[model samples]
Target: MKVSVVTLLQESNVENFNSGLEVLKKQTLGFDNMELIVIDQAESKSEEQIIELAQLAKKANVRVQHDNSLKVEELRGKYISFFDFNYSTSPHLYKNLCQEMDKHSVDFVSANLITSIREDRNLAGAEEVIGAGVHAMTGLKLINKESLLKMAGENKIELSDSFIELLNVNFYLRPFTFNYVNKQFYRNKFTFNESYVNNSISHIRYIAEHVDLSASKKSVSLMKVQLLKHLTFLLDKNMFTDNLSEEEQAAAYDVLRNFLGLVSKKEIQSNDLDGYTPLFNMVNKKLDEEATHYIKLLRSKRHWYEQTNKYKQYFEKNPYDLEESLSWKLTKPLRLFNKWSIEVKQWFYKVFLLTLAAIWKPLTFNRKIWLVGEREDQAEDNGYFFFKHCRENYPKEKVYYIISKDSPHLYKVKKLGNVIYHSSLKHQLYMLVADTYISAWTFDECSYPAPKEKFIKMFGKQLAKKFTICLQHGVIIHNISPYLHKDRYNQNLIISSSEYEKKIIQNTLGYSDQEVAVTGLARFDNLHELSVKKQILIMPTWRRHLFKINKSNFLKSDYYKA
Candidate 1:
């Protein structure tokens, strides 16, 4: 065969496979000289899907195989390309690119990919899709199968399992000819939320660390431009957002640090960064004049309720290390006074109100009471699911859901019996006496009327033995040990949907096997009886950088547009 078109498939993109198949079936270069290799990567391939895929393959006169059973050396094609399940290509795309590949004898060939095309711009000759593999859309590019395998052999990469990684790594491998077709033949057919900012930062670091200094001047300039452009994009679009967590802020700093170190060896022109200066003096033990002045200015502008975007312009060009200010030092006494005031009030609540509620301790002792909540103001998530299950199935059991009295969801939750107002007297009583407290959010968000630390401080050792369950809102697919760690959340039990997730909880969160259960989420039970819908449901997960933006800014974001 002259060409091998490999398609990546998973449960998420399986629906789009047939359309991609149609694009290939109508190829200007006939199927007699081409072979389609379908690699199914989905976890549990259904018999129906398998049969349907077989039928499609038979109709198209192509080959279909699971990723596990396929061998790279067995591939009959001379040149290899990829098929992005959600993208459509021109009928002659493969033929056109292959002709150029053959004529030029280039190792890689690509076209101008459309839809969210960031790397296509002229970035000082480096913009020809070299170290930006993560951003470069698949299916628009092709590589010589023999050369790819040869590179894999030299690099010790297993092409069958790590084909994608090999391809990404190949982008940085120098002395390989690359050809780019200016025609926009490949177009994305769908839009999805990308962890672009974080991914770009990672890719930039990778290229910066691995790029060859002995390469052409144009290549070195390209590397510099790529780094600067990616950093600038992130600074303008994400770094200035209102809702940056402390950890995320630190991560941003790390990226900046890496970029500074990478470019420090060479003299980068001021124009190369588009007038954005890198804060290279931040690592110095003593503050510089400019940094000191900036810190003082920021301190004077700081207020109790300062708007998030008020000092954005100051940070537009470069982010400085000004997290701590002189005002913070001066406010220590005032902060301690405020803390004392709050403690006194809490002491009063614990002494008087808690004493009053303690009278009903005997009543709660005889019965097992489960206090559940989601968002303080809403009845959703796994906590609500479990609460609903208990209320509906075991009417005699005591299960109380908490929602704020002023919340719009209060009326809806009230329809379900045994509901209590959030932070109310009754809520506090229940929190103190309940056998178990459960939430999809933090314990403070549901169980405690105030912060959990205050509750701990007020109750002391009395609340230590209380059982709390973390009915996680979603499946933990990535490492979030910082949030879920036992030292941070300190729940008795955590509900996990899969064994893989249970292991992550145990291994990363430092939970014992007994403490973490693979019981799955209670919400999954509700999913069993759901009516089938002839529609698509797209529930994109939240990104850390975009978490705290206001509605206006959110609506204007590229994430919202996508």
Candidate 2:
């Protein structure tokens, strides 16, 4: 099997690059089965400097791509290995990793690494390790290219430097066997600096976002290890200086708050110190008074879960168990009732629409169209685009927009001339008379049965025809089965960006190729005309459970502060 040794060259240090390439050449033999892919990302390097580096790579028989745009589909390799420019590997590392993987029939294998950082001195062990905690991507490891690609997905072209560690953790969390070759195969010459604290904390926040505490035990263990590692690093005065900036200190506080908020009080109590009492003591002695105060607060604040009977009853029944609680069992009926109520309400609405369709006159071809979006509270997405297009191109076309009762964009949609804005509840008459229906989401709000209703709505008569056009909100990243519910699949035309997305929609939603239109998203038009600004826009989606508990204080969340 071929191995692609991928190295990201972020800095324009030709000397370092040459040295790293030379080390790779000297350490590993038989370049026939190996391909070196150098990703050059030094923006400051001129054309001449880039050409020089490319020439060096060409001499070494290595392929070079200028920039960090890595499309895994374009790469040719059975196994992909990552290396840092500052690190040197053992000659037999690749061979050893391959042997270990084959011996154990594992997905990937990583070996212990020797780093310049003093904290990592005791990290290397003689015994073979097999778990997610081995930090697979950090050191020299041969990963199954297919598995890594599937986990990372197509959109993740390149990972930010701060997030690489989190990527490794996410990869290891997958349900695959991982093995550690009980030997130091790589040496890291780079030393940890002041940014280490911030990076480590960012990683903790990443864990909080990605990891499901209720799902995987291995993930939980890894989270604990990462937390402890960050804490230990903060406590280590030898590594960390006392001159932390105000911003850094504030960031540390936010990280601690988020960390405490994510984990349970019992988990903290159970794993506190964990035989690292010396490190704990050092933290108390060396850490600043403000840092110590945050730590104290974290230790004292009761986890929200602890107050719930769902947690208390679980432990009361079995202290060491990781199963669902009696409280969850007791609330099952209530949960089912809520779900049943929503479905029943949807059914009643559909029935009511069908009843109205039976008596209502066929739609009149008057160039009138109705538009709606995913959320009732906004006039955005494809629906908004279609509305804008109609106003500019087809001014004679009578357009009506459906807005929720409390929609914030109500005034904005009403300001458009010759456009009628109707509350969602009072739009049934408009739906019956409208020539066509355009929407960014499913037509669940206006239940119009296809084939029958399609004939009535489009041809202005009882002739067989279709009317509704579905302008999907975004590109499909994962399986689209969840969103293809109710009347979504019954739409006459489903707008898609590319052939790949069309295929995904076809396969997932069981839509015929003819029914799906490969047109670009309407909102993305004239994107290049927009002026660039030096501002960050954060759009966070709401979670039901969190919102239900702390709806008022959501804006004050540590996540938002960070």
Root-mean-square deviation of every model: 17.2, 24.6
Q: Report model 1's TM-score to 2 decimal places.
A: 0.43
Q: Give each model a TM-score.
A: 0.43, 0.43
Specify the poorest-scoring 10-residue window by lDDT in model 1: 283-292
How much does candidate 2 score in TM-score?
0.43
Candidate 2 per-residue C-alpha lDDT over 1-562 given as tens digits, one digit per residue, 9 for 90 to 100 = 3677787776423436656766677655456567788777766665766776767567444777766667776667778777777776777777777677667776777766653223233332212121223343345667888777776676647655545555565545556567656564577655455555556566666655665345367555645555545544573332232334545555565655555555554555565444444333433444444454444344334345456767689778877543387877788899899999977876676567656655553443444455444456667777777777777787776676666556787676776654443433335545655556677876544333333343244434422233767888788745656466324447777888999998888888777878899988888885757888999997654333344322224445665566
Tens digits of per-residue lDDT for model 1, 1-562: 8888777676545667667667887878776778877767776556767786878578444776653454556667888776667668788887888898889997877766664354445422334554453345232667887766665443333223234533543454456667656664588665332333454455555555555566677656655655655565564442323333434434655666666665643444633542334234552322233432343344445442265555665577557545367887788889999999987887887887577657787766668888888888777678778888888899888889988888776766677689988777887778777778889876665557756676668775656667988999998876776887899879899999999999888888989999998888998998888998799878676566567554445667787888
**Candidate 1 colliding pairs, count:** 0
How high is the CA lDDT of each candidate model?
Answer: 0.66, 0.59
Q: Candidate 2, 193: how far from true, in Å? A: 1.7
